[model samples]
Target: MKQKDLIAVFDNDRDLVKAIGTLKENNIPVKDVWTPFPVHDVLKMLGRESRLPYFSVAAGVGAVIVTFAFLYYTAVIDYPIRYGGKPYFAFPSFVVIIFLLTILLTFISTVIVFQVRTGLFPGKEAEVPVTGTTDDKFVISVGSKEGLADEIITEAQVILSANGAVEITEQER
Candidate 1:
């Protein structure tokens, strides 16, 4: 379903961040933000955080444990080899392969988890809220048509404009 949103565009990151801060202070709920480069403060202001890193860490740890367990089983139980007076359970030799596999699995799991969480896949249609958002523009989108009162929307637009929004418009998102 399409929903109407009030979008404020800014030419610089400062204006965008300032507008977000002001809107937040006014108790206005911002739907989303878009920018060519990430603005670290904006994420904090919006109370948004990503769990991808935690997932990556878990994947890396699991990979290491599974790889080490498999190596131990194969070397000691499945096929015990006593050659050159070397120990059957070689720990040092497994380090390199374990490290490599952990890295590989972590990378793959992070990508897969991000894609799944974001609902992104190959050949998916792009949803661009405004032009130049992926280039030099920063956009702050406020969902307006559904739950927000018209008075609040108007107040939000005024706040955005006062805080240096270059342009503000309403569109169905």
Candidate 2:
């Protein structure tokens, strides 16, 4: 889908950071940035905190709880069976399944969460201003509303190019 966003592309990381700083100084809110690799400085510039770790922890804990509950309800309440003189509600017997399912479910949930949160999925095209972003280019985008409409986008493009942006473009969502 097309998005109405003003994107400033920079050939180098330094240029991107500089453009971002300029935009911030001018009181422009950045929508997002795209880079070939993780840029720690960009995160600092954007003032965004990492949430993936917490999401991961939550996924793991949820998986363990669900697996344990399912196993206990099934083995201890649904149907009971004795094997090798072991208790029907043997805790040890559920360890392997719990461990394996926890890991598997955690991984699955993490991936699903990431994809859902990031708007990424199979066969969906990403909304980007330009190509080559995943190779060596960096892009800084500002949304086109909230006082940052066409006129603001024009101002942004001028500031970006002057501050070292290589290519600038606007898209409509």
Query: Residue 32 in model 1: shift from native, Å?
Result: 0.6
Q: After superposition, how far is residue 126 of candidate 2 from its true place, in Å?
A: 2.5
Weakest 10 consecutive residues of candidate 2 by summed lDDT: 144-153
lDDT of each: 0.88, 0.84
Candidate 2 structure quality by residue, lDDT tens digits, 29-108: 79999999888889998987668779989888998899999998988888877789999789988999989998999888
Model 2 lDDT vs. the true structure?
0.84
Model 2 pairs in collision: 2-173, 3-172, 3-173, 4-172, 4-173
Predicted structure with the largest lDDT when compared to the true one: 1
Clashes of 1: 0
For every candidate in turn, the CA RMSD to the true structure comes to: 2.0, 3.7
| Model 1, TM vs. native | 0.93
In terms of TM-score, the best-performing candidate is 1
Model 2 misplaced regions, further than 4 Å: 1-6, 48-50, 147-159, 169-173
TM-score per model over all chains: 0.93, 0.76
* TM accuracy, model 2: 0.76
